[model samples]
Target chain A: MIKVKKEFILKYGVPSLAVIIVAIQLCLVHFQDLSRWKGGGFGMYTEIHYFYNQIHVSGMSVDSLIKDDPSMRSTLGYLMLMPNDKNIKKAAELVLKTTHKDSVYLQIWKPIVNSENGLYKKVLANEIHLKKSEL
Target chain B: MNYWSAIEIKLKDQIALASQLLLFMLGSYVFILAEEHKLWKILVLFFGLIAWLFFRNKTKHPIIWIVFFVLLTIDLFYSYFWVANHHFMLVFMVLSVILFSYHKQSDILLKNIQLLLVIVLLASVMQKITSKQFMSGDFYYHAINLGGLFKFFFTIFPESLEIAKSNSESLTTLKELNPNLTEHIVLKDVFPNLSFVSRVFAWLTVIFEFLVAVAILWKPKKIGTHIIFIILLFGILFTRLETGFVSLLAISGLYLCKNIKLKLLYVLIILGCITLIITKFGYH
Candidate 1:
């Protein structure tokens, strides 16, 4: 019985854990707009939605904002890479603290293709409007 | 000892050696990446390499594996949002090796790695199949035309470089003007049948990934299975230049592979990936 249990754990344990992780990542991708390129779903480059997705902060480009405040680069990058609400709100709050703005508007823009004409366009994937009071 | 027992011991030793070499190479490559330049990361990499070089045989110590695994876990948590998918795979691979070192179970480690390869490939195929952009070939179309991931193709299709540059400029303009604007910029194709080519490549990716997964699961020891995996690895290396991911896949392949010649080839591929990574010739 011990040998059988050992064999089963050796054979099935890690792979089963991997499967569960993949399932959760799939759900996150489908529901939370997490990029297929991330979160270890092993789905890199399956879609155009990647880290290249743009994050706009109060109508300012993330790059421009970084130029203005270099310290926020990492936080902004985190937000841009995965624009889910938690990251979005965190980034918005950071911008609020750094820039001392009354309210912060954060929007994530992702590239999409019009299949009929093969034209590429940027579409809003997610957005958040945060007031200092909310935080 | 009996002959069979002797052979088993020899094989187990080989597995240990292969795992040590592969992990050392992976650590070196990861440390060399620009994003991994933090002081603590450098110190961990330095200590790991020093221990590996001078006390190569001592790496079988479970404590060493545990230390590396713990540091890697910390790094992953610190950069969770920005960490690549392969980084996660690396962590698990290290964990498996740690288990092997602790329990002295080569079979379990090999089985775990084989299962990992199968699952990752199958998951990739599932994602590609489910993605509307991938199915419509739009993803590959943009990838080839934009020229970062598939930039190696520009050497063969020189005209594609010009198209990529033009497309980049247009996209930049559109972004600079107004991201929320509904204007769609029509992209130029490098060739008359670019769309068809992209579609064919996209479908081929799905088919090859699916075949490789099935092959690994069905007959991992077969030479034919190894050949298909080699083909898939080289195919992705040229097109995507994902040296880190490719090297990880090859290491896992090496762990499951029994044939001597294929093992050598996997070693060579891993070395080539390291060279590519160090030179920044391809994506890390």
Candidate 2:
């Protein structure tokens, strides 16, 4: 029995963990708008949507707000890569705190290609309208 | 002699050598292109080179492996957003080596490495198949025209370069325009039959990846399996110069390889990958 347990663990342990991780990654990709190229799904180069997605902020001066704050820059970078609700909310809150604004508008845009006519366009993948009190 | 004991004794030297090579590969990757954290890069390079040179008996220096593993894990979490898939594989590979260092079991380590290769490839294949853009070949089409790693395709079809330039200009214009404007720019494709070519490339990618995964799982120790891996590596390198990933795959292949000639080839590939990285070839 001990030998069997050892064999099973030795053979199946890491691979099983890998499968579970992949499953979680798929969920993130499906629901949370996580880029297929990230989170260890081995989904690199599978789609035109890459980690270079753009984050747009409205109703505030992003440059003046993030110029001195390295942490906000890093947070925005993460938000570009993963623009899920949580990251969007986090970024919105940061904007609200920095600019002393009542609310901020944030949108994540990903480049997409229309196959029929080869038209290139940026589509909104996620958006958030968060107020100061919403945090 | 007991079966596992004999097997361990037989593979003892080879596993040590494999561990050293993997450490070197990991170190080189971090030093060259990975590890956005500067302090971690220096530490990994220092310890990796030290371990590679002086630590002949890896079991005696468990702390080094532990430190290396911990550093890689920290980096993985720190830069999780931008980290490549191969970076994750590197962490898992180090973990397997750490396990081997503890248990002194070569077979388990080999099995784990084999399984890693299979799972990664299968997952890649699954992702490609399930993605609508990939199946329709739009992804490859965009990549080839966008001029990163797929710029080599321009040599075959020179007119696509002009199209790519136009596309770039249009995309730049589009970006500069109002964000709320729902305008679509029609990207030009002047290269003849480029769509068909992209479809062929996409299908070939899926088929080759699936075949390589099956080959590795079917015969972990056979020369044929190694050949398939080499073919896949070259296939990917031709279009996309993923030197880090190529070296990682070669290191895992080396762990399972017993033949001297193939083993030498794997080492050469790893060194070649390092050289490619140093030269800044295909670096975007």
Candidate 3:
């Protein structure tokens, strides 16, 4: 074993250990899915569950995807307005599609886009209350 | 030497070690509570422990504190809302460490720490007093009923029959709606007539917070006052188990002891930190 001086350890040890700990912590971000999931229950909805899961599916930044695709926006809008796994999974699926040319996401979008009553805009505006900043 | 002089000497000698112990304890709690994987949390805690032991006495350098700050900031970003109170404590510890390193003066650092504690306590009092739900005791009632503490107490106490009966029904409905909300209710609330004891506890919480704010500034050299502060802190910790105990341990060390042998305290804190971090593995 290599010999390390007590004084040297005293000076560099804690900070080095701290850096290592931080590095490990940062690395764990990649495996968040495997570690745990706090999906909402009790009639309430968790927006971030959809937000992060959808982001993973889309492989794009939230703002960039929302800007580039109407379907992604509507999926998010559906998530904010509607509760349940089916709708949320539909939103996640929308992100995986190559383009929004087809009206496959219409059911999710109808409430958010087709209304002249401004209900869609209200739902979209309510996204500000969402816990996940990325969503 | 007079009593006041003895107390002052004790405080001057032990405050640094006490603050360090507090930081270690708080850091440990945060590590365990952080939203990360078991392997990662363990790795971080193991390395962090070795590092903390090495630098426990090296308060002379600012780099150690800066490193801790950087780690805390990263943890804050990863679990922004879950561990917010833990983040707050880290921020205070980091700021205090920086101040102590630069000034290299015990008196100035103590004063600043005192100021920070006072502000925190006063702010808690202000929040309690201003909140409509908190004042009316509804918040506490819901919290206690939800946390199951009310049921626990109801079972033990014969005189609390009214509260027990009413709160049991409420608990069933609330838990059915959201099973997780019943985890940790810090308020110790009681419903049904807002029972005299629960109301007293509620008002006393606000008053005690205010008194703690006052105690920090009233007489720094009095042993009696420090004891009162420690008791008040423990009282708060009883209701709120998460972050209050760390502060209690810290304040006990900083303001209570005169010439404490910190080796034992440090070991205990380190152990607790490890245990807490281990607890975090799958919690998040």
Deviating ranges (above 4 Å) for candidate 3: A1-135, B1-12, B33-62, B148-193, B243-249, B252-284
| CA-lDDT, candidates in order | 0.78, 0.78, 0.44
* DockQ of predicted candidate 2: 0.66
lDDT of 3 by residue, A32-104 (tens): 2211111111010101122212222222345666896776776665554343355555665555454432222
Off by over 4 Å in 1: A58-61, A68-71, A131-135, B1-14, B33-60
lDDT (C-alpha) at residue A133 in model 1:
88
Q: What TM-score does model 2 achieve against the real structure?
A: 0.86
True contacts kept of 1: 0.67
Candidate 3, residue B135: CA error in Å?
A: 0.8
Fnat per candidate: 0.67, 0.71, 0.00
TM-score of each candidate structure, all chains considered together: 0.87, 0.86, 0.51
lDDT per residue for candidate 1 within A1-135, as digits (tens), equals: 998898778667778877887898899888877778888888888888565577776656666668856568877777666778888888888889977778988888888875446688888878999998887
**lDDT accuracy of residue B115 in candidate 3:** 55
For residue B126, model 3's alpha carbon misses the true position, in angstroms, by 0.6
Candidate 2 per-residue lDDT over residues B95-161, each given as its tens digit: 7777777667778899999999999999999999989889888887777666654667777867777
Which regions of candidate 2 fall more than 4 Å away from where they truly are?
A49-51, A59-65, A133-135, B1-17, B32-61, B155-159, B279-284
Best model per DockQ: 2
State the lDDT of candidate 2 residue by residue for A61-104, as single tens digits: 55666798998988887787677888888888888887788888
